[model samples]
Target chain A: MDGDTRETIREVAIDLFSTRGFDQTSLREIAERVGLTKASLYYHYPSKQALLTAIVSPLLDGWRAVTDEAEGMAHTPDNVRHVLTTLLDVMVVNRPLASVLLRDPAGVVAAAGPLWQDMIDVATRLTNWVAGPEPTVAQRLRAIAAMEVLRAAYSSITYLREEVADAEMREVLLDSALGALRR
Target chain B: MDGDTRETIREVAIDLFSTRGFDQTSLREIAERVGLTKASLYYHYPSKQALLTAIVSPLLDGWRAVTDEAEGMAHTPDNVRHVLTTLLDVMVVNRPLASVLLRDPAGVVAAAGPLWQDMIDVATRLTNWVAGPEPTVAQRLRAIAAMEVLRAAYSSITYLREEVADAEMREVLLDSALGALRR
Candidate 1:
């Protein structure tokens, strides 16, 4: 029951955050929606930022895991495709969270401060791994381009203001990233 | 003489902002570097943000011009390549200003405010032009990817923490954006 309550609170918070914008939504509203008293909500998650951290952590963990795994693999054409596909999946699956982040970059970036930096560091490593060993300037630049290409998976949601199917995002983004890689 | 002093202040401010970061660099330091009192600097450009705006306006103008020009041309492979090359030149030529913006996106975006939104609007038009008439979701996604790829022209300065020759930036970013466009 306690686990279920926590999960319910998370789902409610994400829905509120996505629909209402992070800053506009308050803890009282979230607690009201979750059918929890403000105190109960506080027991589960102390602050709005704590809830946001909870929401964004998995996406960060997904990237870090993908980077770690890719670092262990060979930098071949097949492996690059596989890694990019996984990264896209992680991003697409987390689209709700990403929408919240993208909608208010200033507030979210400030709140997520260190988490944002961690993501950057993870991205740098992933880009390096994608560049392969002893990359020339062109190769390094291509790697950066390919990574940026993958961002469309989520940014398209905001820009298009509509749902692009996850399958379509995976197919289009994966191919586009590989194209940028010149593979 | 007034115009030269204003230009000199912009140059010194870019240098300091690029090295010490936008948030860390002070208007007084910029004045000192340019051999102006803060009062003199204010006469030319009222505030730190005004100085940044002066430095960044040309880059934004260049983008708006490219988008304006490209909108008039029919989207063809040759035109696409030509437009991409022109965009790369704008980014590469304004890299010093871009480096400051990229180094501190939160600060810059907040400061840029409406100008940043204008850039996004201009970028949307440029991407739409690149996508052409009756674009599919795939084409639209590809256009977004290509624009992101072009960001490497300036982002590389911060990411690599070194100068990538303008020639190399233009060559690699153009080809990479074209590749993402699948042209």
Candidate 2:
């Protein structure tokens, strides 16, 4: 019920879910990690689905902000670079949550159908920013590839356990993402 | 099981699994699609996991072949081109299986743990070929982004339902993939 307990529960859930996968993890595991009883955890979040819904809600809001801001920006290479950088910032700040989300996109889609649809809509808008507001097929493909790089920034095993600090990896990944959209 | 019936079941299962997702799909659903009783379907594949294993096995083999070949070749841009082109061929030949595999990566990882590990190993080998056997950090990142584009060749909703024929999409996707690696 309190902010501290809820935040702690959410963090532990995200850590377990991101590494082991959403299905492989359970509320008990999260509660054990958070040092809470199942009933106590349920008092705050009723279900695993509810916990995930709580985690993703704010992430979706951040993504919405990026996409909405991108809509008013110019569709130039500089714009693409700036957009990808901003997107990567959001993903990195919420790296654990992003990993949990990306870890099992299809499972998430099945479990949270309406939420997944919202994600797809946000993705569509984000890709438009990367590919340009009006993109050719090649540009569209490039945009998607660049987006994958941003997804990889947090989601992939490489980035998740990178020897480099998150700050350095962010710059490196941003460069790679911009390079992907270069063509 | 007869070859015809087994192949038909596999095809229908792949179609359903790829579109709907592996976990969400039930054995009964697959059997219904194939006009078979659950008992009859169980006679071939004891479980949905077995069906997926049967489907992904050949794909794993194909990937193995690509990685093996790339291992022998020089790490030139031309070789990277050849490897990606060949990878695309394998993907196109087994688009449905690729889609199924990509659609629910985490579910597949959970249900088919060792098999998925083998896939990650193969992917690592393949990326080495594309990024050069001894790659720098940037090369490694580019290799991954390029691989993501190849993944897009089949797994993405856009390419999966392109108004363009599979052949045309293949070419378009191939170009996009090569472009990703052009550091």
Candidate 3:
């Protein structure tokens, strides 16, 4: 139950989950990899779903925080740019977790219902805020598209396969998102 | 079955699947709604999966056609715009089917593995062609983002709840996608 062991277990679970898939990877295998008995592993994670929740919660928390901040800010061009930049930073840091969670989006939704719902709700809020008050239909569509452009941060890992630098991804995607929302 | 009955069945199935979900809808329910016995329905579709495949094949075929056509065209800006517009049209026509298929993407992938993989491969080819020959990492990333923007054609149904007209969805999403790809 020490911090190091907990972190090690989490690291091992992410590796297994990403390579082997969330459903395909078993808690038994995770325990074996971490040299812990099944009972001891359960003591930490409780269940496979719990382990997944632990793995992806950071990304969810980051997105929620972004939405909360956006709610308070004026929907000015500069503020929109700042919000997008921070959101991209969150995605960049959580790219590994995104790989696990978004690899099969519906599967993640089914496996972790509340967590996935929270992420969806956060995205909807962020999209609404970006759309601004009394936004035109076109403005709302641009906001949705802009949010989707930011998703390229993680999708680059799948499509380009580590060929693009993280900084380049941040820059290109941020600019592209702004361009998507351009007046 | 006659062509009219067959088409009617497909329409009814799409309605049920979109509202109730692909996994939640059963062949028996579709049969009941279509006023046919289960045996009669089975005679046509063979399984719920077959019905889904029948429902979504048009969209998949449209996408595959776009990819195939793009394969021959030079990756000029004019061609890119044409391709995006054509892709948007395909999505617009298939918005209802897109709702059924994309509502639970992983579930559809599981239910129709080969069809889903074929769609993914077609998407990759389209992305590559859109990226152009000997593309830079940044160019490839933009191609991916642009493709994601085009996805809003269907996602608009989920988010905007049919408030955005098909014409508006086509116009705005095409513009946003091009903007995402703009250098």
Best by TM-score: 2
The residue-by-residue lDDT of candidate 3 on B40-157, one tens digit each, is 9877777878888998888889999999999999989999999999998988888788778655554576678799888878888989999999998888988999988887766665
- How well docked is model 1, in DockQ terms? 0.30
Q: Give the per-residue lDDT of model 2 (tens digit) for B1-183.
A: 555998899999889888877876888898898999888997887777788899999999999999999889888778778888898889878877888876776778888878888998888777767777666666666677677776665535552234445675567666776666665
Tens-place lDDT digits, model 1, residues B18-38: 665666567778878888787
Judged by DockQ cut-offs, the docking class of candidate 1 is acceptable
Q: Estimate each model's TM-score.
A: 0.76, 0.89, 0.82
Per prediction, the TM-score for chain B is 0.85, 0.89, 0.90
The C-alpha stretches of model 1 lying farther than 4 A from their native spots are: A1-56, A95-118, B1-5, B12-42, B47-52, B100-113
Candidate 2 docks with a DockQ of 0.40
CA lDDT for candidate 1: 0.80
lDDT of 3 by residue, A58-108 (tens): 988999999999899998889999999999999888877877764445445
Give the C-alpha miss distance for residue B47 in model 2, angstroms. 3.2
lDDT of 2 by residue, A116-181 (tens): 789878878777666765567766766776777666654345422345466765776777666666
